[model samples]
Target: MDSALAVRALDESTWAAFAELVEANNGVWGGCWCVGFHVKLGKGRTAAQNRAEKEQRVRDGETHAALVFDGDRCLGWCQFGSPDELPEIKSRRLYEKGLTTLPDWRITCFFTGKGLRGRGVADAALGGAIAEISRLGGGVVEGYPEETDDRKVSGSFLHTGPMAAFEKHGFTRTRPISPHRWVVTRTVA
Candidate 1:
Protein backbone atom coordinates (compact mmCIF):
# COMPACT_ATOMS: atom_id res chain seq x y z
CA MET A 1 0.00 0.00 0.00
CA ASP A 2 1.37 3.36 -0.99
CA SER A 3 0.78 5.60 2.04
CA ALA A 4 -0.37 8.28 -0.28
CA LEU A 5 -3.48 10.42 -0.46
CA ALA A 6 -6.12 8.71 -2.53
CA VAL A 7 -9.06 10.38 -4.23
CA ARG A 8 -12.55 9.05 -3.77
CA ALA A 9 -15.87 10.19 -5.12
CA LEU A 10 -18.04 12.18 -2.72
CA ASP A 11 -20.65 9.50 -2.36
CA GLU A 12 -22.66 8.10 0.52
CA SER A 13 -19.89 5.73 1.49
CA THR A 14 -17.46 8.57 2.05
CA TRP A 15 -19.88 11.14 3.42
CA ALA A 16 -18.68 10.68 6.99
CA ALA A 17 -15.09 11.51 6.18
CA PHE A 18 -16.17 14.50 4.11
CA ALA A 19 -18.44 15.77 6.86
CA GLU A 20 -15.72 15.38 9.46
CA LEU A 21 -13.36 17.53 7.44
CA VAL A 22 -16.06 20.14 6.95
CA GLU A 23 -16.94 20.14 10.63
CA ALA A 24 -13.30 20.64 11.55
CA ASN A 25 -13.12 23.66 9.27
CA ASN A 26 -16.15 25.47 10.69
CA GLY A 27 -18.34 23.91 8.05
CA VAL A 28 -16.05 25.54 5.47
CA TRP A 29 -16.41 29.26 4.69
CA GLY A 30 -18.98 30.18 7.27
CA GLY A 31 -20.66 26.80 7.25
CA CYS A 32 -20.97 26.55 3.50
CA TRP A 33 -20.83 22.75 3.42
CA CYS A 34 -19.11 23.21 0.06
CA VAL A 35 -22.49 24.00 -1.49
CA GLY A 36 -22.12 27.70 -2.14
CA PHE A 37 -21.49 27.10 -5.83
CA HIS A 38 -24.46 24.81 -6.10
CA VAL A 39 -26.95 26.97 -4.26
CA LYS A 40 -26.89 30.63 -3.50
CA LEU A 41 -26.61 31.24 0.23
CA GLY A 42 -28.56 34.35 0.79
CA LYS A 43 -29.22 35.79 4.25
CA GLY A 44 -30.80 33.50 6.83
CA ARG A 45 -29.35 30.38 5.22
CA THR A 46 -28.23 28.32 8.15
CA ALA A 47 -25.34 25.90 8.20
CA ALA A 48 -27.58 23.04 9.22
CA GLN A 49 -29.63 23.48 6.08
CA ASN A 50 -26.52 23.43 3.95
CA ARG A 51 -25.34 20.22 5.54
CA ALA A 52 -28.70 18.54 5.17
CA GLU A 53 -29.07 19.53 1.54
CA LYS A 54 -25.51 18.58 0.74
CA GLU A 55 -26.09 15.14 2.18
CA GLN A 56 -29.28 14.75 0.15
CA ARG A 57 -27.47 15.75 -3.00
CA VAL A 58 -24.74 13.24 -2.33
CA ARG A 59 -27.28 10.50 -1.75
CA ASP A 60 -29.08 11.47 -4.91
CA GLY A 61 -25.86 11.65 -6.87
CA GLU A 62 -26.46 15.31 -7.59
CA THR A 63 -23.22 16.41 -5.97
CA HIS A 64 -19.75 15.52 -7.21
CA ALA A 65 -16.37 15.96 -5.59
CA ALA A 66 -13.05 14.19 -5.25
CA LEU A 67 -12.31 13.66 -1.59
CA VAL A 68 -8.62 13.37 -0.75
CA PHE A 69 -7.77 10.95 2.01
CA ASP A 70 -4.58 10.11 3.87
CA GLY A 71 -5.19 6.62 5.21
CA ASP A 72 -8.88 6.71 6.20
CA ARG A 73 -8.93 10.35 7.25
CA CYS A 74 -10.12 12.83 4.66
CA LEU A 75 -7.82 15.80 4.36
CA GLY A 76 -9.49 17.82 1.62
CA TRP A 77 -11.70 17.81 -1.42
CA CYS A 78 -11.93 19.24 -4.94
CA GLN A 79 -15.48 19.90 -6.00
CA PHE A 80 -16.47 19.45 -9.66
CA GLY A 81 -19.81 19.13 -11.36
CA SER A 82 -21.74 19.91 -14.49
CA PRO A 83 -22.54 23.53 -15.33
CA ASP A 84 -26.12 23.05 -14.34
CA GLU A 85 -25.11 21.29 -11.17
CA LEU A 86 -22.87 24.17 -10.17
CA PRO A 87 -24.34 27.29 -11.71
CA GLU A 88 -23.58 29.78 -9.00
CA ILE A 89 -19.95 30.91 -9.30
CA LYS A 90 -17.68 33.78 -8.48
CA SER A 91 -17.59 36.77 -10.81
CA ARG A 92 -20.84 35.62 -12.36
CA ARG A 93 -21.21 38.78 -14.38
CA LEU A 94 -17.76 38.47 -15.90
CA TYR A 95 -17.85 34.70 -16.12
CA GLU A 96 -21.02 34.76 -18.20
CA LYS A 97 -20.19 37.85 -20.26
CA GLY A 98 -18.31 35.87 -22.88
CA LEU A 99 -19.72 32.43 -22.32
CA THR A 100 -20.13 30.51 -25.53
CA THR A 101 -20.05 26.86 -24.57
CA LEU A 102 -20.04 25.21 -21.17
CA PRO A 103 -17.39 22.74 -20.17
CA ASP A 104 -18.52 19.22 -19.49
CA TRP A 105 -17.30 19.58 -15.94
CA ARG A 106 -16.64 22.58 -13.73
CA ILE A 107 -14.03 22.60 -10.98
CA THR A 108 -15.81 24.76 -8.46
CA CYS A 109 -13.91 24.73 -5.18
CA PHE A 110 -11.30 23.06 -2.98
CA PHE A 111 -11.04 22.77 0.80
CA THR A 112 -8.10 21.49 2.80
CA GLY A 113 -7.77 20.69 6.46
CA LYS A 114 -6.80 23.60 8.72
CA GLY A 115 -3.45 22.11 9.72
CA LEU A 116 -2.49 21.17 6.15
CA ARG A 117 -2.24 24.62 4.63
CA GLY A 118 0.71 25.43 2.29
CA ARG A 119 1.27 21.77 1.72
CA GLY A 120 0.65 19.66 -1.44
CA VAL A 121 -2.92 18.78 -0.41
CA ALA A 122 -4.51 21.14 -2.91
CA ASP A 123 -2.40 19.81 -5.76
CA ALA A 124 -3.22 16.26 -4.79
CA ALA A 125 -6.93 17.08 -4.57
CA LEU A 126 -6.81 18.60 -8.03
CA GLY A 127 -4.97 15.65 -9.49
CA GLY A 128 -7.63 13.50 -7.91
CA ALA A 129 -10.36 15.63 -9.46
CA ILE A 130 -8.95 15.30 -12.99
CA ALA A 131 -8.52 11.58 -12.56
CA GLU A 132 -12.08 11.28 -11.27
CA ILE A 133 -13.37 13.32 -14.18
CA SER A 134 -11.53 11.06 -16.58
CA ARG A 135 -13.07 8.05 -14.94
CA LEU A 136 -16.52 9.56 -15.37
CA GLY A 137 -16.09 9.87 -19.16
CA GLY A 138 -13.52 12.50 -19.99
CA GLY A 139 -14.40 15.77 -21.58
CA VAL A 140 -13.70 19.47 -21.43
CA VAL A 141 -13.09 20.52 -17.83
CA GLU A 142 -12.80 24.08 -16.57
CA GLY A 143 -11.59 25.70 -13.34
CA TYR A 144 -11.62 29.23 -12.02
CA PRO A 145 -8.23 29.62 -10.37
CA GLU A 146 -6.65 32.70 -8.91
CA GLU A 147 -3.22 33.77 -10.18
CA THR A 148 -1.06 34.26 -7.11
CA ASP A 149 2.12 35.43 -8.77
CA ASP A 150 2.56 39.16 -8.16
CA ARG A 151 0.82 39.63 -4.83
CA LYS A 152 0.24 37.90 -1.55
CA VAL A 153 -3.22 36.35 -1.49
CA SER A 154 -4.68 35.13 1.72
CA GLY A 155 -5.22 31.39 1.79
CA SER A 156 -8.71 32.03 3.16
CA PHE A 157 -9.78 33.19 -0.30
CA LEU A 158 -8.39 30.31 -2.34
CA HIS A 159 -11.51 28.14 -2.48
CA THR A 160 -10.96 27.72 -6.19
CA GLY A 161 -7.28 26.96 -5.71
CA PRO A 162 -4.37 28.59 -7.59
CA MET A 163 -3.50 28.77 -11.30
CA ALA A 164 -0.09 27.15 -11.06
CA ALA A 165 -1.64 24.18 -9.31
CA PHE A 166 -4.05 23.72 -12.18
CA GLU A 167 -1.36 24.36 -14.77
CA LYS A 168 0.83 21.57 -13.48
CA HIS A 169 -2.19 19.29 -13.89
CA GLY A 170 -2.54 20.31 -17.59
CA PHE A 171 -5.16 23.08 -17.31
CA THR A 172 -4.40 26.12 -19.48
CA ARG A 173 -5.64 29.63 -19.23
CA THR A 174 -8.68 30.37 -21.32
CA ARG A 175 -9.45 33.94 -20.24
CA PRO A 176 -9.42 36.30 -17.34
CA ILE A 177 -12.79 36.29 -15.68
CA SER A 178 -11.64 38.74 -13.04
CA PRO A 179 -8.64 40.80 -12.06
CA HIS A 180 -6.67 37.84 -10.70
CA ARG A 181 -8.94 34.92 -11.54
CA TRP A 182 -8.35 33.08 -14.82
CA VAL A 183 -10.74 30.71 -16.50
CA VAL A 184 -8.53 27.66 -17.04
CA THR A 185 -9.60 24.71 -19.12
CA ARG A 186 -8.38 21.28 -20.16
CA THR A 187 -9.68 18.32 -22.10
CA VAL A 188 -9.42 15.37 -19.75
CA ALA A 189 -9.35 12.22 -21.78
Candidate 2:
Protein backbone atom coordinates (compact mmCIF):
# COMPACT_ATOMS: atom_id res chain seq x y z
CA MET A 1 0.00 0.00 0.00
CA ASP A 2 1.20 3.52 -0.68
CA SER A 3 2.20 5.49 2.37
CA ALA A 4 0.93 8.71 0.81
CA LEU A 5 -2.77 8.19 1.35
CA ALA A 6 -5.00 11.27 1.27
CA VAL A 7 -8.37 11.85 2.86
CA ARG A 8 -11.37 13.15 0.96
CA ALA A 9 -14.90 13.98 2.09
CA LEU A 10 -17.55 11.70 0.60
CA ASP A 11 -19.67 13.82 -1.71
CA GLU A 12 -20.91 13.98 -5.26
CA SER A 13 -17.47 14.35 -6.78
CA THR A 14 -16.04 11.54 -4.66
CA TRP A 15 -18.99 9.19 -4.81
CA ALA A 16 -17.53 6.94 -7.48
CA ALA A 17 -14.43 6.30 -5.47
CA PHE A 18 -16.51 5.57 -2.40
CA ALA A 19 -18.69 3.19 -4.35
CA GLU A 20 -15.70 1.39 -5.72
CA LEU A 21 -14.36 0.84 -2.26
CA VAL A 22 -17.66 -0.46 -0.98
CA GLU A 23 -18.19 -2.74 -3.92
CA ALA A 24 -14.72 -4.10 -3.57
CA ASN A 25 -15.36 -4.92 0.06
CA ASN A 26 -18.36 -7.14 -0.68
CA GLY A 27 -20.75 -4.25 -0.17
CA VAL A 28 -19.17 -3.78 3.23
CA TRP A 29 -20.65 -6.52 5.38
CA GLY A 30 -23.29 -8.41 3.44
CA GLY A 31 -23.94 -5.60 1.04
CA CYS A 32 -24.67 -3.05 3.72
CA TRP A 33 -22.94 -0.23 1.86
CA CYS A 34 -22.44 1.13 5.37
CA VAL A 35 -26.10 2.03 5.54
CA GLY A 36 -26.95 -0.13 8.53
CA PHE A 37 -26.29 2.71 10.93
CA HIS A 38 -27.65 5.43 8.72
CA VAL A 39 -31.23 4.23 8.60
CA LYS A 40 -33.62 1.91 10.34
CA LEU A 41 -32.32 -1.61 10.10
CA GLY A 42 -34.24 -4.80 9.15
CA LYS A 43 -35.70 -3.05 6.15
CA GLY A 44 -34.84 -6.06 4.00
CA ARG A 45 -33.35 -3.94 1.28
CA THR A 46 -31.22 -5.80 -1.21
CA ALA A 47 -27.64 -4.86 -1.92
CA ALA A 48 -28.76 -3.10 -5.06
CA GLN A 49 -31.38 -1.15 -3.14
CA ASN A 50 -28.90 -0.19 -0.48
CA ARG A 51 -26.47 1.00 -3.11
CA ALA A 52 -29.09 3.06 -4.88
CA GLU A 53 -30.34 4.64 -1.67
CA LYS A 54 -26.85 5.37 -0.46
CA GLU A 55 -26.01 7.10 -3.68
CA GLN A 56 -29.21 9.10 -3.50
CA ARG A 57 -28.37 10.15 0.02
CA VAL A 58 -24.98 11.31 -1.14
CA ARG A 59 -26.65 13.30 -3.91
CA ASP A 60 -29.14 14.74 -1.44
CA GLY A 61 -26.40 15.54 1.04
CA GLU A 62 -28.02 13.29 3.58
CA THR A 63 -25.00 11.13 4.38
CA HIS A 64 -21.43 11.80 5.44
CA ALA A 65 -18.07 10.05 5.61
CA ALA A 66 -14.35 10.60 5.35
CA LEU A 67 -12.80 8.54 2.59
CA VAL A 68 -9.16 7.56 2.66
CA PHE A 69 -7.52 7.12 -0.70
CA ASP A 70 -4.26 5.79 -1.96
CA GLY A 71 -4.02 7.91 -5.03
CA ASP A 72 -7.23 7.11 -6.94
CA ARG A 73 -8.10 4.01 -4.94
CA CYS A 74 -10.26 4.47 -1.86
CA LEU A 75 -8.68 2.56 0.98
CA GLY A 76 -11.35 3.00 3.65
CA TRP A 77 -13.73 5.42 5.37
CA CYS A 78 -15.16 6.65 8.67
CA GLN A 79 -18.87 7.40 8.51
CA PHE A 80 -20.14 10.34 10.58
CA GLY A 81 -23.16 12.56 10.60
CA SER A 82 -25.70 14.30 12.83
CA PRO A 83 -27.75 12.14 15.17
CA ASP A 84 -30.69 12.64 12.86
CA GLU A 85 -28.54 11.93 9.85
CA LEU A 86 -27.37 8.76 11.52
CA PRO A 87 -30.25 7.76 13.75
CA GLU A 88 -29.40 4.07 14.06
CA ILE A 89 -26.40 2.88 16.02
CA LYS A 90 -25.00 -0.08 17.88
CA SER A 91 -26.52 -0.96 21.24
CA ARG A 92 -29.22 1.64 20.78
CA ARG A 93 -31.29 0.37 23.69
CA LEU A 94 -28.50 0.99 26.17
CA TYR A 95 -27.04 3.96 24.31
CA GLU A 96 -30.17 6.08 24.74
CA LYS A 97 -30.83 4.85 28.23
CA GLY A 98 -28.05 7.06 29.56
CA LEU A 99 -28.15 9.75 26.93
CA THR A 100 -28.25 13.25 28.34
CA THR A 101 -27.50 15.21 25.20
CA LEU A 102 -27.02 14.01 21.66
CA PRO A 103 -23.70 14.66 20.08
CA ASP A 104 -23.40 17.13 17.25
CA TRP A 105 -22.06 14.28 15.18
CA ARG A 106 -21.84 10.54 15.55
CA ILE A 107 -19.24 8.25 13.97
CA THR A 108 -21.20 5.14 13.23
CA CYS A 109 -18.93 2.89 11.20
CA PHE A 110 -15.56 2.33 9.52
CA PHE A 111 -14.33 0.13 6.66
CA THR A 112 -10.85 -0.53 5.35
CA GLY A 113 -9.98 -2.20 2.09
CA LYS A 114 -9.08 -5.87 1.94
CA GLY A 115 -5.55 -6.62 3.24
CA LEU A 116 -5.30 -3.00 4.35
CA ARG A 117 -5.88 -3.46 8.06
CA GLY A 118 -3.17 -2.43 10.55
CA ARG A 119 -1.87 0.06 8.03
CA GLY A 120 -3.29 3.08 9.88
CA VAL A 121 -6.04 3.57 7.30
CA ALA A 122 -8.79 3.58 9.94
CA ASP A 123 -6.84 5.97 12.15
CA ALA A 124 -6.40 8.24 9.19
CA ALA A 125 -10.06 7.91 8.29
CA LEU A 126 -11.01 8.91 11.86
CA GLY A 127 -8.75 11.95 11.79
CA GLY A 128 -10.09 12.78 8.38
CA ALA A 129 -13.68 12.48 9.63
CA ILE A 130 -12.93 14.84 12.51
CA ALA A 131 -11.24 17.26 10.15
CA GLU A 132 -14.24 17.10 7.85
CA ILE A 133 -16.54 17.67 10.84
CA SER A 134 -14.53 20.72 11.87
CA ARG A 135 -14.72 22.00 8.35
CA LEU A 136 -18.47 21.53 8.42
CA GLY A 137 -18.66 23.62 11.63
CA GLY A 138 -16.99 21.98 14.54
CA GLY A 139 -19.14 20.58 17.30
CA VAL A 140 -19.50 17.79 19.80
CA VAL A 141 -18.64 14.42 18.27
CA GLU A 142 -19.21 10.93 19.60
CA GLY A 143 -18.57 7.30 18.61
CA TYR A 144 -19.11 3.76 19.86
CA PRO A 145 -15.95 1.70 19.68
CA GLU A 146 -15.32 -1.59 21.35
CA GLU A 147 -12.75 -1.93 24.13
CA THR A 148 -10.36 -4.27 22.33
CA ASP A 149 -7.68 -4.25 24.95
CA ASP A 150 -6.54 -7.82 25.72
CA ARG A 151 -9.17 -9.17 23.31
CA LYS A 152 -8.63 -10.37 19.79
CA VAL A 153 -11.71 -9.19 18.00
CA SER A 154 -11.92 -10.01 14.33
CA GLY A 155 -11.63 -7.01 12.07
CA SER A 156 -14.91 -8.01 10.45
CA PHE A 157 -16.73 -7.28 13.71
CA LEU A 158 -14.95 -3.98 14.26
CA HIS A 159 -17.11 -1.89 11.97
CA THR A 160 -17.47 0.57 14.85
CA GLY A 161 -13.70 0.69 15.13
CA PRO A 162 -11.54 0.18 18.22
CA MET A 163 -11.47 2.22 21.41
CA ALA A 164 -7.81 3.03 20.88
CA ALA A 165 -8.70 4.61 17.55
CA PHE A 166 -11.03 7.11 19.26
CA GLU A 167 -8.92 7.81 22.37
CA LYS A 168 -5.84 8.66 20.35
CA HIS A 169 -8.00 11.03 18.31
CA GLY A 170 -8.99 12.86 21.56
CA PHE A 171 -12.37 11.25 22.25
CA THR A 172 -13.00 10.22 25.85
CA ARG A 173 -15.26 7.52 27.17
CA THR A 174 -18.52 9.12 28.24
CA ARG A 175 -20.27 5.93 29.34
CA PRO A 176 -20.42 2.24 28.73
CA ILE A 177 -23.24 1.42 26.38
CA SER A 178 -22.68 -2.32 26.63
CA PRO A 179 -20.24 -4.78 28.11
CA HIS A 180 -17.68 -4.01 25.42
CA ARG A 181 -19.16 -1.00 23.70
CA TRP A 182 -18.39 2.43 25.16
CA VAL A 183 -19.75 5.80 24.14
CA VAL A 184 -16.77 8.08 23.53
CA THR A 185 -17.22 11.81 23.28
CA ARG A 186 -15.11 14.79 22.22
CA THR A 187 -15.81 18.35 21.23
CA VAL A 188 -14.18 19.70 18.10
CA ALA A 189 -13.43 23.38 18.20
Candidate 3:
Protein backbone atom coordinates (compact mmCIF):
# COMPACT_ATOMS: atom_id res chain seq x y z
CA MET A 1 0.00 0.00 0.00
CA ASP A 2 1.10 3.54 -0.64
CA SER A 3 1.94 5.43 2.53
CA ALA A 4 0.37 8.56 1.12
CA LEU A 5 -2.88 6.83 0.16
CA ALA A 6 -5.99 7.59 2.17
CA VAL A 7 -9.46 6.07 1.97
CA ARG A 8 -12.87 7.47 2.83
CA ALA A 9 -16.53 6.54 2.43
CA LEU A 10 -18.50 8.26 -0.28
CA ASP A 11 -20.78 10.87 1.24
CA GLU A 12 -22.20 14.27 0.48
CA SER A 13 -18.97 16.09 1.28
CA THR A 14 -16.89 13.69 -0.79
CA TRP A 15 -19.29 13.36 -3.71
CA ALA A 16 -17.61 16.12 -5.66
CA ALA A 17 -14.28 14.38 -5.55
CA PHE A 18 -15.82 11.14 -6.77
CA ALA A 19 -17.61 12.91 -9.59
CA GLU A 20 -14.45 14.63 -10.69
CA LEU A 21 -12.57 11.36 -10.89
CA VAL A 22 -15.31 9.70 -12.92
CA GLU A 23 -15.54 12.66 -15.28
CA ALA A 24 -11.83 12.65 -15.85
CA ASN A 25 -12.11 9.05 -16.98
CA ASN A 26 -14.60 9.96 -19.69
CA GLY A 27 -17.67 9.34 -17.54
CA VAL A 28 -16.54 5.83 -16.64
CA TRP A 29 -17.47 3.20 -19.26
CA GLY A 30 -19.53 5.67 -21.27
CA GLY A 31 -21.17 7.73 -18.56
CA CYS A 32 -22.06 4.86 -16.27
CA TRP A 33 -21.51 6.82 -13.09
CA CYS A 34 -20.82 3.45 -11.48
CA VAL A 35 -24.52 2.60 -11.36
CA GLY A 36 -24.77 -0.06 -14.07
CA PHE A 37 -24.83 -2.86 -11.54
CA HIS A 38 -26.82 -0.93 -8.95
CA VAL A 39 -29.92 -0.49 -11.04
CA LYS A 40 -31.70 -2.34 -13.82
CA LEU A 41 -30.37 -1.88 -17.33
CA GLY A 42 -32.37 0.72 -19.13
CA LYS A 43 -32.09 2.00 -22.69
CA GLY A 44 -31.97 5.48 -24.17
CA ARG A 45 -30.40 6.98 -21.07
CA THR A 46 -27.85 9.65 -21.77
CA ALA A 47 -24.67 10.29 -19.84
CA ALA A 48 -26.32 13.28 -18.17
CA GLN A 49 -29.18 11.12 -16.98
CA ASN A 50 -26.87 8.56 -15.54
CA ARG A 51 -24.89 11.27 -13.78
CA ALA A 52 -28.05 12.76 -12.32
CA GLU A 53 -29.25 9.39 -11.08
CA LYS A 54 -25.92 8.65 -9.45
CA GLU A 55 -25.81 12.06 -7.80
CA GLN A 56 -29.30 11.57 -6.43
CA ARG A 57 -28.42 8.13 -5.17
CA VAL A 58 -25.43 9.58 -3.33
CA ARG A 59 -27.55 12.35 -1.79
CA ASP A 60 -30.10 9.79 -0.70
CA GLY A 61 -27.40 7.63 0.82
CA GLU A 62 -28.31 4.78 -1.47
CA THR A 63 -24.82 4.23 -2.85
CA HIS A 64 -21.74 2.83 -1.13
CA ALA A 65 -18.09 3.03 -2.15
CA ALA A 66 -14.58 3.16 -0.77
CA LEU A 67 -12.98 6.21 -2.32
CA VAL A 68 -9.19 6.26 -2.51
CA PHE A 69 -7.34 9.54 -2.41
CA ASP A 70 -3.79 10.73 -2.82
CA GLY A 71 -3.61 14.00 -0.95
CA ASP A 72 -6.37 16.10 -2.55
CA ARG A 73 -6.78 14.02 -5.70
CA CYS A 74 -9.26 11.18 -5.94
CA LEU A 75 -7.48 8.20 -7.46
CA GLY A 76 -9.86 5.26 -7.37
CA TRP A 77 -12.85 3.55 -5.74
CA CYS A 78 -14.37 0.18 -4.87
CA GLN A 79 -18.16 -0.14 -4.97
CA PHE A 80 -20.04 -2.27 -2.46
CA GLY A 81 -23.59 -2.73 -1.22
CA SER A 82 -26.04 -5.22 0.15
CA PRO A 83 -27.64 -7.80 -2.15
CA ASP A 84 -30.82 -5.76 -2.21
CA GLU A 85 -28.89 -2.58 -2.91
CA LEU A 86 -27.06 -4.16 -5.82
CA PRO A 87 -29.34 -6.96 -7.01
CA GLU A 88 -27.84 -7.15 -10.46
CA ILE A 89 -24.46 -8.70 -11.21
CA LYS A 90 -22.45 -9.00 -14.39
CA SER A 91 -23.20 -12.68 -14.80
CA ARG A 92 -26.49 -12.65 -12.99
CA ARG A 93 -27.99 -15.78 -14.48
CA LEU A 94 -24.95 -17.92 -13.83
CA TYR A 95 -24.38 -16.52 -10.35
CA GLU A 96 -27.98 -17.02 -9.34
CA LYS A 97 -27.97 -20.54 -10.68
CA GLY A 98 -25.50 -21.51 -7.97
CA LEU A 99 -26.61 -19.09 -5.24
CA THR A 100 -27.35 -20.66 -1.91
CA THR A 101 -26.87 -17.85 0.58
CA LEU A 102 -26.90 -14.10 0.36
CA PRO A 103 -23.84 -12.14 1.36
CA ASP A 104 -23.93 -9.22 3.75
CA TRP A 105 -22.12 -7.07 1.21
CA ARG A 106 -21.10 -7.40 -2.42
CA ILE A 107 -18.10 -5.74 -4.09
CA THR A 108 -19.41 -4.91 -7.52
CA CYS A 109 -16.87 -2.71 -9.26
CA PHE A 110 -13.41 -1.12 -9.02
CA PHE A 111 -11.76 1.77 -10.81
CA THR A 112 -8.41 3.57 -10.73
CA GLY A 113 -7.29 6.75 -12.37
CA LYS A 114 -6.30 6.62 -16.08
CA GLY A 115 -2.54 7.00 -15.59
CA LEU A 116 -2.55 5.41 -12.14
CA ARG A 117 -3.43 1.87 -13.17
CA GLY A 118 -1.47 -1.00 -11.56
CA ARG A 119 -0.25 1.28 -8.80
CA GLY A 120 -1.87 -0.47 -5.84
CA VAL A 121 -4.75 1.99 -5.80
CA ALA A 122 -7.29 -0.83 -6.18
CA ASP A 123 -5.69 -2.67 -3.29
CA ALA A 124 -6.13 0.36 -1.08
CA ALA A 125 -9.76 0.62 -2.15
CA LEU A 126 -10.35 -3.06 -1.35
CA GLY A 127 -8.75 -2.70 2.06
CA GLY A 128 -10.81 0.38 2.70
CA ALA A 129 -14.00 -1.47 1.82
CA ILE A 130 -13.19 -4.27 4.19
CA ALA A 131 -12.34 -1.83 6.98
CA GLU A 132 -15.50 0.20 6.42
CA ILE A 133 -17.69 -2.90 6.38
CA SER A 134 -16.02 -4.24 9.49
CA ARG A 135 -16.53 -0.94 11.26
CA LEU A 136 -20.22 -1.11 10.37
CA GLY A 137 -20.28 -4.70 11.68
CA GLY A 138 -18.40 -7.57 10.16
CA GLY A 139 -20.11 -10.00 7.84
CA VAL A 140 -19.50 -12.04 4.72
CA VAL A 141 -18.12 -9.77 1.99
CA GLU A 142 -18.39 -11.05 -1.56
CA GLY A 143 -16.53 -10.08 -4.72
CA TYR A 144 -16.49 -11.04 -8.38
CA PRO A 145 -12.96 -11.03 -9.73
CA GLU A 146 -11.65 -12.29 -13.02
CA GLU A 147 -9.14 -15.17 -13.13
CA THR A 148 -6.69 -14.17 -15.83
CA ASP A 149 -3.68 -16.35 -15.17
CA ASP A 150 -3.16 -17.96 -18.54
CA ARG A 151 -3.44 -14.90 -20.77
CA LYS A 152 -2.77 -11.20 -20.63
CA VAL A 153 -5.73 -8.92 -19.94
CA SER A 154 -6.35 -5.23 -20.27
CA GLY A 155 -7.03 -2.89 -17.39
CA SER A 156 -10.53 -2.10 -18.65
CA PHE A 157 -11.57 -5.76 -18.45
CA LEU A 158 -10.09 -5.95 -14.97
CA HIS A 159 -12.55 -3.42 -13.58
CA THR A 160 -13.91 -6.07 -11.25
CA GLY A 161 -10.30 -6.62 -10.15
CA PRO A 162 -8.02 -9.62 -10.51
CA MET A 163 -8.66 -12.81 -8.58
CA ALA A 164 -5.18 -12.80 -7.07
CA ALA A 165 -5.81 -9.47 -5.34
CA PHE A 166 -8.93 -10.80 -3.67
CA GLU A 167 -7.10 -13.95 -2.66
CA LYS A 168 -4.31 -11.89 -1.10
CA HIS A 169 -6.98 -10.30 1.08
CA GLY A 170 -8.02 -13.79 2.25
CA PHE A 171 -11.02 -14.13 -0.02
CA THR A 172 -11.57 -17.70 -1.10
CA ARG A 173 -13.12 -18.67 -4.38
CA THR A 174 -16.66 -19.86 -3.77
CA ARG A 175 -17.59 -20.84 -7.34
CA PRO A 176 -16.98 -20.09 -10.95
CA ILE A 177 -19.62 -17.84 -12.41
CA SER A 178 -18.27 -17.53 -15.92
CA PRO A 179 -15.37 -18.72 -17.99
CA HIS A 180 -12.93 -16.35 -16.38
CA ARG A 181 -14.92 -14.83 -13.52
CA TRP A 182 -15.34 -16.37 -10.10
CA VAL A 183 -17.30 -15.56 -6.96
CA VAL A 184 -14.83 -14.95 -4.16
CA THR A 185 -15.60 -14.06 -0.58
CA ARG A 186 -14.21 -13.43 2.89
CA THR A 187 -15.70 -12.93 6.31
CA VAL A 188 -14.71 -9.53 7.59
CA ALA A 189 -13.69 -9.48 11.21
| Tens digit per residue, CA lDDT, model 2, 1-189 | 346989998999999999998888889888898888877657668899889989999999999999998888888999999999999888989988999989999999999988887778999999999999999998999999989878889987788989988999999999998899999999998
* Every candidate's CA RMSD: 1.7, 1.3, 1.0
Off-target runs (Cα >4 Å) in candidate 1 are 1-3
Regions of candidate 2 where Cα sits further than 4 Å from its true position? none
Off by over 4 Å in 3: none
What TM-score number comes out for model 3? 0.97
Comparing candidate 2 with candidate 3, which one achieves the higher lDDT? 3
Give the TM-score (vs. native) of candidate 2.
Answer: 0.96
**Model 3: per-residue Cα lDDT over 1-189, one tens digit each:** 778999999989899999999999989988888988887758987789888988998999998999999988899999998998888788889999999999999999999989987668999999999998899798999999999987999887888988988999999999999999999999998
Give the Å error, residue 64, model 1.
0.8
**How far is 11's C-alpha from truth in model 1 (Å)?**
0.6
Estimate the TM-score of every prediction: 0.96, 0.96, 0.97
C-alpha lDDT of all candidate models, in order? 0.90, 0.90, 0.91
Question: What TM-score does prediction 1 earn?
Answer: 0.96
